[model samples]
Target chain A: MTAFIGEFNCKLDEKGRLSIPSKLRAQFPEAVGNTLVVNRGFEKCLVLYTKEDWLDETAKLNAVDDFMSPDIRRFKRIFTNGANLVQIDGAQRILVPKKLLEYAELTAEVILVANGNKIELWDQAIYESELNVDAAEMSQLAQLFHQQRNQG
Target chain B: MTAFIGEFNCKLDEKGRLSIPSKLRAQFPEAVGNTLVVNRGFEKCLVLYTKEDWLDETAKLNAVDDFMSPDIRRFKRIFTNGANLVQIDGAQRILVPKKLLEYAELTAEVILVANGNKIELWDQAIYESELNVDAAEMSQLAQLFHQQRNQG
Candidate 1:
């Protein structure tokens, strides 16, 4: 299993292809090869999951008893709503699906947040303004975390 | 790999223990056994990853060239800032760490959004009020997704 970390400043070409940072690329497991799954994130960003991880996700959806719940049906539909399976070309770049590009509002500049199992693609401005936590808040969150951790 | 789907309504017992929905629990890969990793999410919620999946995440973090960027260092600190490891007991329940529970504001009622490789635990009221997309938005989102998927 491969879990990703770090944030990289990257760019999308005029053709809408974004180059994967080599350091991030190096983290891809052999099982994932060149295939990647791109989808809308819970937030207004995009998520990149390795092909192997994507398969596991699909298997989970497949196990759902959809008929038993409309929420499940809707979730299955929307969770995979604009998902695209892309391959890294020889140049280590992937064509951002136009619709997804529009959805995430990606332009020339983008940021790749290599979160655990998924990579988040965000417009640089949106990422900085929306996702960046202030130092005070982070300190509080960290303190709360450590408090519970020590208790356990 | 195991992917999860659907949202399940649940409750936190007096002891702050949450029972994993049997359906969702069934989705856990055998390799995961009873171990789980709980951490603060990018959003104001808690994220649960299978132990196997968590290990993969750590592996990615280990590969990072931290000395190259201060951004990476800060991200690493906040990303796993409040991470905790817990186990599902014989009753299939895991104790939500006290501080994490308070951080997420999870009280009696809770909602579990089993997304792909991880599960997001949110306060039911907060989830409904903050995360629920109205019908019009869902339709628009669906249209955009289908258009992009078809283009490929």
Candidate 2:
């Protein structure tokens, strides 16, 4: 499958609805229907997942021994709290829930980034600053990732 | 795109190459080109991502402050170390690398599971056991996920 790629800019309507950008629209299969799951993500970004992906993600959380530690329980609680099912209308738009919008600090201007398995919706300026990190830092990241794989 | 769904069993050749089942193959876009990334996944499964997805995943790693703490560093290391690129041959087969194959304990029979952004390769028997979690646990999981989202 073509991996979800590129960055998309979307305008959240006054009622908090935003159309799924064509870029992402192209990645979806027609048969999966129009359901989606939106949740609060790291930083000030929100995460969007096809419903199937949401269940898959929940399994990951299920595997985590949340009761093992207070930190893990807290993290899981916050993460799960943000998840909500949404429907993409005939025009391929979704109305971002108010609390979720607030959780991610979303505004009229938003940037959507495809992260392979999921999409990240970010406030425009926040997205830009995120991309502004030093190139050296980015380079180091690749190196670090490599170090882990090589050992395995 | 349709959230990739379905399970197909495959026979691993002596060389460890497995063909992409027609079911999952149907999910891929024809024009994206054939490169893919395979990596170790949680719970003894192998995760497959299109090369495009790999780059998207790198962005997630980039966001983590590598020097922030030992836990994140260790987690990232283990996660990243198992990643490797595999090219799909004209016949639509991918050769699992030795290290990755070992990581997932793959053998003669394998199960391919579609989990939205990625496809998981699992040992046939292992996959069944994973699906064997009690109904109550599964029910409770759905409840937990909703409990978190409901308050939001």
Candidate 3:
């Protein structure tokens, strides 16, 4: 499997539409004609996926036994209920809903798109302010990867 | 901002190539034009990211204090050296490095792509064997989202 990497700084238009990077756009011919799912990302950003992948994920969420506990109900309410299904327009832009935009604290100006298996959308100011890369953290992360590799 | 909120079953071709589902392609435009950084994910899977995102994350990893402790070194080695940058082809397919395939215990048959802010690539058999979205887990995950939303 190919890993998606890199960070991109771009602008979110007035309507909260982000222009999918051209290179990134080339990755999804199939998604061009169908509905795409967008929702809150684990990190302080947004995530987008295909309907198939979304369904697969939702199935697991649905399988959660909410009747078993309050935690289950809360989980369904947060992750499941918060999810939104969106369609990509011909311009290769997905309209960021006001609620979701607000959730991510996006102000419709500049946003940061960080590359991952799924793309992360972030407010430019927040992303920049939150960006704290020091030498110490790098080493720690590297070691974590090494240990996992060895264990695997 | 959109979220990719689920898991998916996928396959890695004999050549270490995994097909980005057509529908999900929109989620990863970076894979179409730029290189990807494949690394060890938290769970038993490989993580894919765009170079930009990887760099941002690596910056965080790079921030680790190398002189702090032995454990830090391990993390640095794993996350830094253990990471592989793979290119996405015109077909939007990415080649998983041999070492990564082995590290993730992928046998070149089936794999799973769990979508979130980042994509987690897992061995299909292993993913199937281990994937269990019980009510408890779901609820816990949902609560986390809710908490994050409130905080954000």
Candidate 4:
């Protein structure tokens, strides 16, 4: 598996549409996908997953034995309730559903980050803040990502 | 940061050079990254991180406070001890250090998997086995990743 890599700065137009950089879009492996699923990410950012990856993720979420487990339910609901099928148009742009745009607090400018399995869309300032880490704050970040990843 | 995506079937040449697929290479924002760090990943695979991502990963690993913590020590050692600075050649191939090849049990054939922050190099068969996840294994995977991440 080749991870999608690199970061790109982009914009959200007045209609909440985003133009995924062609540089980024061109890496899609047809076997894993060209289709995409947009949904809430672990953090405030929005996550975009290839359709194939989405199925793998959904399968994991589906493995939760207790459907009534609050963590499982909340996690599933947050993901599925907000999940939207999307595509980059001929112009290499994708329309961010109004709810998704709001979920990520995206304004005019945004940063599209490629994390291993998905893409995280963050408010530019927030994205910058997240990456500007220093040594002393290490432990704090450890706790932060831990809590965030487990927030369910 | 871009999460690496897609699975690629590749090989470790007699000289131990791994040719990163052109498709994946095309995703890099730069003509070629100035630096790369190859290290031991939590799984039985070798991880290749762009210098920028390695810095972020190091920041997280640096959070471990107790040198006496065996788990933390082992995790840190795996990453640091195996970490090697490498360059991708003009032909878009990287020389896999002999030690790393042995560490990941790479034979003539291998697979490069794109993970969010890094590329995982695995012996082809091992990679396939690792990916054959079943429902009962989901919780186990969740636990394994949690423990691995917390070790730092």
Better of 1 and 3 by TM-score: 1
List, in order, the clash count of every candidate structure.
2, 9, 47, 21
* Shift in Å, residue B143, candidate 1: 58
Name the lDDT of candidate 4: 0.72
Q: On a 0 to 1 TM-score scale, where does candidate 1 land against the true structure? A: 0.49
Superposed model 4: Cα runs more than 4 Å off: A32-34, A67-71, A139-152, B1-152
Which of the two candidates, 2 or 3, achieves a greater TM-score against the reference?
2
Alpha-carbon RMSD to native, per candidate: 20.0, 18.6, 18.8, 16.4
Docking class for candidate 1: incorrect
**Model 4: what TM-score for its first chain?**
0.83
Q: How many backbone clashes does candidate 1 have?
A: 2
The residue-by-residue lDDT of candidate 3 on B56-96, one tens digit each, is 76666545444355455344433443355677688868887
Predicted candidate 2 versus true structure: per-residue lDDT over B23-68, tens digit per residue? 7887887754777778777678898887666676676674665335
TM-score of 2: 0.50
Error of 2 at A109 (Å): 1.4
The 0-to-1 C-alpha lDDT of every candidate, in the order given, reads 0.80, 0.75, 0.64, 0.72
* lDDT for position B39 in model 4: 78
Per-residue lDDT of A97 in model 2: 96
User: Model 4 residue B149 lDDT?
Assistant: 90
The candidate scoring highest on lDDT is 1
Give stretches of model 1 more than 4 Å off.
A135-152, B1-152
Query: What value does the TM-score of chain B take for model 4?
Result: 0.78
lDDT-wise, the better of 3 and 4 is: 4
Model 2, A23-43: lDDT tens per residue?
Answer: 468777775588888998766
